[model samples]
Target: MDLEPPLSYGHGICRPRGFAKDPLVKTVPAIEALHPEMTEWRRDFHRHPELSFEETRTAGLVAQRLRDFGLDPVEGIGKTGVAAVIDSGKPGPSLALRADMDALPMDDRGGKDWHSHTAGVAHTCGHDGHTAALLGVARHLAAHPPASGRVVLIFQPAEENGLGARAMIDDGLLDRFPFDEVYAFHNMPLLAPGQAGVRTGPTLNGYIVWEIAVEGVGGHGAAFFKATDPLQAAARLAAEISSIVGRYLDPAESGLITVCSLQAGHSHNVIPAHATLSGTMRALKPEVMELLYQRLETACRGVAELTGCTIACKRLAEVPPCVNAPEGADRAAAACAEVLGEGAVIRDHPPFPFTDDFALFLEAAPGAYLFLGQESAMCHNPAYDFDDALLPVAASIFTTLVRQRLGYAGTHARSVAPPST
Candidate 1:
């Protein structure tokens, strides 16, 4: 199946609620009430960025905030991650809402006043915004407990390295706070601020990293035929590997292979005995991903044989494509439209080449991953910053999803069953 569909193209149908309406106006008063504290929370996080799997300070703050919101908080999942449960006073099925809490390893070039104080660590991916938005939901939901069911607010770590979600699952996150449905969101820099792009199925691509090493014989520059240069062999491999995207893979299939790094010897006059090359591989389908990997290995081996060199290949990180459940995505879209307005939520756009760890969660539960526009530069760029204006919209959307799934309006409140210990 062609997994690279146009953005916002959900196979399931949604009831029309008019064109592009603002869904937050009704909840504005409530959000406004919480705006000051939310902004402070985001700024504090922005000033202190933490890299993947090293979110101690960030995780601590999240746990403390959840406790203050009256939710029982659990920490140390996935090493430096946290999860909290808000049990409503009524009865219904449980729901989960997740937000990633790890920052990228990069220098902040945005020059914002609240830029990262930790050298070489920054929230270039807008994780600070995601964390604060979820915190906003926790605070709001705490003040006004949902009418029924329970809410599991997850503050995940190591999203940049694609390990947080996997860690939580392995640690029995679902078992601790079992739920019928789960949901998560990411901030997209390309889209306009305050606007959201939500798709029902196959939203993000799959990614794999490969490292190749070529070994040859070193010799002095004066030697005419004594040295077998691994650098030349590696160069040939890079050029040939680039063709995997264009020739080996189907033209219709979306795939990319880029050789990002190549390292060799130090002396200018001598041929290096070994050369190392590393790059990323991306595809929208599993078969295509496998095809790319196989083609790359074949190309590298062929180049090594022709050049009289030894080749070694290692597969690094592999993340599966994020496929949203059709029914779950439909429900999320309706909830988004109802909370952010039909106009504020755009249903169609291009699929992101980037990968998300949330795909792991979808494997165990029905859920949807939506994008909230940051209105800044692209993610991973040093110029990126989260637009605080979108926090209320996100929080309101989260709140609405909880209320809708539990079948409660704003007025009535209830308590839910305690999760089995």
Candidate 2:
């Protein structure tokens, strides 16, 4: 169950040759053949990026691809999301694999030939790569069904906004698909290409966005006694809120409260009537997140009262932390080792501050979220691109995991269990 093997940089332990020689590698030929198509799909997606809950074309593309793969595709389950079901002939446990399908509101600076053609919107977070990888898996699974279970392929939207996962759950995604285990992968630029990283639990921090508005009397700046400056209230609120993390949060719990933006008066000589502060609170535990929210609210109200200002705090988006199931993590580690060799896998790494909606699915089912090294620029950067060379390796890993879980070998393995009631 311990897959945290020592790793060396540029060791080339799991070369493409080893993958090509493996039997599972042969099953990837179809995926490889569709690589060009996949790339085109990715580029097309990149060129026409869509923001959260507005992925009309993206959803249509995913649905069409699923239909072409001979699976039953369901659309609009989570507001522009798509889910495809691939049933095996026999009966067994059901599994779900998910990928995000949203773009960020940023312009592409990657300068790639297939850069985003859309203005002020791009796949800077590599959701396009995620979508492509899941599509690759869907193709492979369609051709080579599992022996004893069903696979639900989910193309989720609004991950960038941190709402898609919850939206899907709210729409009864689990009730409809009913998966025993769900798995997801994200491309990481921090690691080298073809390398895989997995943590047993709590791979990402919980994040909540909050908006604070302070209102006070506006007056001439020269008359200090005449006005209650909202800007001063905003400043005090920011400083005091930051102190809560340092003083209130447990030292053992990793937490951060960053006031990312502050907006106040337009005139330099006039005290503003209102000021606004917006930022995020990140912590590794739900209790920590809750505590931080309470403390933030108390500080905002206290600062407002102390400054003779009125304040309002609103929660924008709250995403739960991702905790990989122990069993699923062990299985994922084993599959990675089997596909990429033991030495190529890094099992232990510090959890990240980034939040993912995949945590929602994991909360519903026993599952593991994995990070695959892509050797590209870090996510959220316009220069980032998914390492296409890792396609076969990733495909191999997914196939191996499915085979190991279902006790099947070779392509075309059918089902063995009944659908979940």
Overall lDDT per candidate, in order of appearance = 0.79, 0.79
- Please report the TM-score between candidate 1 and the true structure: 0.87
lDDT (10s digit) by residue, model 2, range 1-421? 0012233333333434223333322333455566677677778888888999999999999999888988889999889999988788678888888888999888888888888888899888878877877888888788777778888889999998889988988999888888999888887666655567888989888789999989899999999589988999999998898799889987888888989999998987898899999999987788899999999999987887798899999999998899999998988888877765676677777776678878888888988988777666777776776566666566666767887886553544433222223
lDDT of 1 by residue, 140-214 (tens): 777777778888888999998878898998898989978788899887655655556777667788888899989
- Best model per TM-score: 2
* lDDT, model 1: 0.79
- Model 1 residue 140 lDDT score: 79
Off by over 4 Å in 2: 1-30, 409-421
Cα TM-score of candidate 2: 0.89
